[model samples]
Target: MTQYDVTLEWPDDGTDTVAVSPTETVLEVALREGIRLPYDCREGTCITCVGRVLAAGGDETPGAEEAVDAADAFDYRRQPKALTEDERANGYVLLCIAVPRADCRVAVGPMVRSEVGDSPWS
Candidate 1:
């Protein structure tokens, strides 16, 4: 059983960490653990589940990047710049598609403040 420790953080906030399987998507672990991560599609089409990984301490490999739709609330095309190269390089990962790459520590939530601003779901 491959287990990955996941650490999620919010803006100007602390961290929420949980242990999940390498085969599991971060969103699955989060939802199961009662962590309120806003996401529409369970697939990888929407960007509502975009976040960033801070570190990985386990022994799993990262997953692939998926195409994001422009209609979603957090669409890349809708943003100022659809996921700049630097942002991707900085470890910005989409939770819906990103599987754990070891026991990783990350800031999982809407990367954009405005997307989560009006919602009290966080």
Candidate 2:
């Protein structure tokens, strides 16, 4: 299995780099690495895990030109419902379902407790 490098900017203003398999979601890798990323409804229904792709590639090259647009970079196997068309167009992605095709830098948002119910572990 091929793995891609993933750089995640957490809600608390910390950054972490980890390896993510193509078949796994970004949130999964973060959690496994002990990186606390905001997430709710691991199935992609909730918007709590929304993040923006700052950059994406096999190597770390800084600049907008080197970055992959989150709108186009996200795997289409599962379309997240929390984000609107405009939000997606603006680069918002649900980390719970996003599978990166290349190394990626993502800016995670604050955790929003689910209105439906509180997570027992949270």
Candidate 3:
């Protein structure tokens, strides 16, 4: 399996890097590594686990577009209904369903929750 190092960057908290596979959700890896990220539904229907990609570098995978920019760094396991079209196009991803296609920096915590709407954190 291809492994990616996904860094979670909080507004004021700091950052945590977790090793992830193409098939593994970023949330799964984050929790396993003890880097507690915000999450509620394990599915893609909630915004609690949303994060914004800040930067990324990746190679293209099968059935995926190249990670030319932060917005293109991940693939959702299912349709990510929690985000608006603008959010998705601009790099917002629900970490619970997001599989990294490359090494990336993601902003989580209150910073992200506030922007996504209806988040428990906000």
Best by lDDT: 3
Native-referenced Cα lDDT, model 1: 0.56
Off by over 4 Å in 1: 58-87, 111-122
Backbone clash numbers for all candidates listed: 1, 0, 0
lDDT of 3 by residue, 1-122 (tens): 68989888888868798989999999998888888888888887878898878777844232344323335789878877777777787678899999988887787997778876663333
Sort the candidates on lDDT, descending order: 3, 2, 1
Candidate 2, which ten residues in sequence have the lowest lDDT sum?
112-121
**Rank list by TM-score:** 3, 2, 1
Model 1 per-residue lDDT tens digits across residues 10-109:
7767778877775677778788989888877555445577676555554223352532221221123222222444555555655765666466656555
Which pairs, if any, clash in model 3? none
Hey, what RMSD does candidate 1 come out at? Answer: 9.5
For model 2, the local distance difference test gives 0.70
